[model samples]
Target: MASLPNRKIAAAVVREDAAHRQRLLDRAFALAFKGLVYAQIWEDPVVDMEALAIAPGHRVATIASGGCNVFSYLTDDPAEIVAVDLNTAHVALNNLKRVAILHLPDYAHFRRFFADADDAANIADYRTFVAPHLDETSRRYWEGRDLVGRRRINGFARGLYKRGLLGGFIGLAHLVARLHRIDLGEFLAAKTVEEQRAIFDSKFAPFFDRKLIRWITDQRSSLFGLGIPPAQYDALADGKPMADVLRARLEKLACDFPLDDNYFAWQAFGRGYGKGVAAPLPPYLQEVNYAAVKARAERVTMLHANMTDMLAASDAASFDRYVFLDAQDWMSDAQLAALWAEVTRTARAGARVLFRTAAEPSLLPGRLPDALLDRWEYRAEESRDYTRRDRSAIYGGVHLYTLKAD
Candidate 1:
């Protein structure tokens, strides 16, 4: 038998710097990984899978969340991908998955890499097929196994990481309610679809507008774990004293799409692991990505720096597609312009740039001048349809754009 191999660190662990990860997660919102501290993912875009009809050699850059859509997008087989994120843990996970897909030998090994709980065979598989390819930092990262001794990757198998800050917060609230003889999670996890509706209407509906819940959620400190900064907390809390937008978002989580097909709902309330056969999956994670997914692990350059900084690092007329993925909502006028200048410079003329926001309106209109924003044609109808059909989402909307004809 061969010895376990040392892991390789791809750029996916690009933001492994402690200070950078701290600024994003511990400070932004009190989010955790494997019940530790992953970044907050509230109001994240429901990535437009339909819009991801990749050309033969499209180079795409996307935000690396837990790395779901990155794999989803790969199902279309882009030429390359640049997945940037301020969160190191997320980057690490992306690298890990990409490597797993390439190294795991087959789909079953891939399933064991992410969805298999902490079984002896699973751990052994990690040591054999998976661990050898992981970079040193990532190897160490998974070895720590958190305080719970549950390997972080296996947490995905255990359906833990999918439960983001919002998911955990929902769980905490459900627990609080459970103490008072209310079982919010249980009621939502009804065996039948109709019973689930009854629970949503009778049990979960009132909590959306609860004053105490609003008060706690509105506090920046209270949301520290969710990784929202003081400013973002203020923005998300809406202008009123209570959390109106939050209530709406939560209501959407409960009622937007039927829970049967929506994986986000499973993570939020059903506490399910969407790790079965690739059939019931987002586009990126399907079997199409299995064979070639790891090949692009190194191709994508994950960075903690702003998109503008990333643009400065690249050359002109380079990327065929630039996917902003809602990062522009955090930009200032100068920042937006600077980022756009780089995007436009590196753009391959007809290259497309896409993004999303917290509301129906485009954040770029006032922030970015007309000429800069006009370079890309907004696919409003397509964005709307994608947003509506986004199944693995707890958020309300999505947006898309295509760069103008050269």
Candidate 2:
């Protein structure tokens, strides 16, 4: 498949002998993201809220993945949020969420439309309240039929969580587990973390040791559903058996957080949020934050462009908070430098930037130029603290960088 225009930015960042491999990976990632890959953003917003310390005066710029975090940030009442993404699908999803927040009848309707998405009434709500308000691109995206002859919006009526690439990936995992006579769905039945750990140790943990499972995981293509690129896979696979690394990560996901309140766990294990379990809802989907998000929906501006391009065109000191969301892992030294140059140029006084890494250490020090990197203070201790507290335990590290005082 041809790579999308927005993905060219990711392609341009590769300056290594592995550029050919990287381009192929980027193409796969682009195709994966061309549809709804993330039913929900994987990054934990609670850690973001703490690290960014968003105030009413903050103007934020972030990469819009599934737009879950973008909407979550709205509850903080930031001055403005510029949500940029190269993928048109992500841009459309972000716009759809923003419009739904503004036009949806109530919090209950909102939750039904997105969270408990298997109800037929969600399609009705989309047409009645959200469809007319959608831009032409988003309207077409939602209304268009997919390979199965069902309109994309119909996924809401038929379980939206089970439609996207990530959803398909989870389904594949379930199929494989079944082949091993292990049912991952059983993980959802645990009433406490102890049971969760017990289920994982006995059932899930043994699957990773299977020769078939290990062989399948060793293929880099098998992870396209997770949105990991070739370079990222290399970073993740560094000096470790891929299956073992994955087993440990899944263990963290299964055991580290209380399953009752970890939506990521629910999505991974049960394939959807369990019925009537409202506590695990994403911040934007939670009732207490709904009205605040709706009121501030207009504060967000969605842009279909590369983050580097978007920041390069902006005025100096324009944004106060930057959320990179693991994008830097794909960058080369030159690309990282160019991005930080723009970040440093456009960042307001005391501006803060946060990003995640596939590896444990921050990527900036050796890769980015010192003149650019020196101006920012790395919040090493705070970042370690936040990473531990992050309920979404997929990432290796979460980092925070603050512009030094003038």
Candidate 3:
């Protein structure tokens, strides 16, 4: 049987009394999610920061996945940040990042641990500095052995980004590309968008037409590594072949942004971030923003709980910003209403909510109650623009809603 937190994950992901095949996929997703999913979150914080316009003193509530955006948001210096998640591994990862940021001697050590993430010294550093300062839960998780019997902290020494489910998925993708005699790393060498498009056209786009690729992508379980639960998988597919959707997303990832600035492209193509101090990185990992993020690390409080439950227990009109991060796409109609009701109740005046969707349109119009929907203004035009600007290219929509002034 799954543990309590795993059961909570199942409650969120598994629909009740579905067809046998659907139930299997849902259960498989829940089981896969029991371990680390994302080593680095896929959403673009640069786009998020622009959409939210996070000003100083705002209190932000968000789902803490890989802790990338959580720390990046600290650059804006929010008064308080409440990060909630159901995944125990994610909660542990987030807490570990918090303590590491708090106690690591300098930016170099921090960068080496996260950015490089392939040095044996990192395990030593974790024991010497980060582990002692980490909370008991997080410490135990890091020291604990994974299913393969390697300590979780050893991930840092063995290339952390290449170890999670997402990492394994990417590794498989690279393997597939290799079997086709295509090197994904070639995309990273392109200095211009035209070059990227050319490489993608010649190497990647046609690969989707292969029979094995089509068959594999058609199965919803195949995407579990990307953290696409069954519900979101249906939305992402939208009755179209999954290969087409994936190809389109990969096109955007390859050609829509300069490789020099998009670390997401680096991660996808090079299997990790680009080399050296000058490489593109998340804001929290960048040297220029290091001090600000490190200083504000204490402002964040990570919890292993459902977002709605956490909000329900809080005082009304308390939160200023909300970031859902595609989690809402996993919700049913009733769950959507329940979450939005709590969101509306807890939001302060002029509060903003930002979330990504697997589909191009916002999921709220037909799903959320009119009364609750009437109290917020959806920034459709801005959302569309932000969606295009999102360098990650994995999401189809980036919706923003602002609470109407009382």
Residues 1-406, model 2: lDDT tens digits: 4456545644643334566776676665655656677877789998899899999989999999889899999888899999998767678889999999899999989998888889999888999999999999889988998777889988889898887888889998898888878889988889999999999999989888889888988987778788777677777787788899899889989999998779889899888876784548888988888889999999999998889999999999999999999888888787899999999999999999999987778988888888998999999999999888778787888999999998
Q: Tell me, what's the RMSD of every candidate? A: 6.8, 1.8, 0.9
**Candidate 1 lDDT tens digits, 1-406:** 2111101111111123446643454332323322333322332233554565567688876766666666656656677778776555666666677767777677776655554332456667777877898887767776666555656656544454444454466567667677656665575456566676677777766775677776776665665444444434444554665356665665566666665556566555644434456323444444655656555555555554445667788888878776665555444467678888788788886676666554555666677778888787878788787766655343334666677886
Model 3 clash pairs are none
User: What are the lDDT scores of the predictions, listed in order?
Assistant: 0.58, 0.86, 0.93
Cα deviation at 39, candidate 1, in Å, is: 8.7
Best by TM-score: 3
* C-alpha positional error of residue 178 in candidate 2 after TM-score superposition, expressed in Å: 1.2
Q: Which stretches of model 2 miss by more than 4 angstroms? A: 1-25
- In model 2, the Cα lDDT at residue 22 comes to 60
TM-score, model 3 to reference = 0.99
Would you estimate the TM-scores of all the predictions?
Answer: 0.79, 0.96, 0.99
Clashes of each: 27, 0, 0
Ranking, lDDT, top scorer first = 3, 2, 1
Candidate 2 achieves a global lDDT of: 0.86
Model 2 error, position 64 (Å) = 0.7
lDDT string for model 3 (201-222, tens) is 9989999999999999998888
For lDDT, the strongest prediction is 3
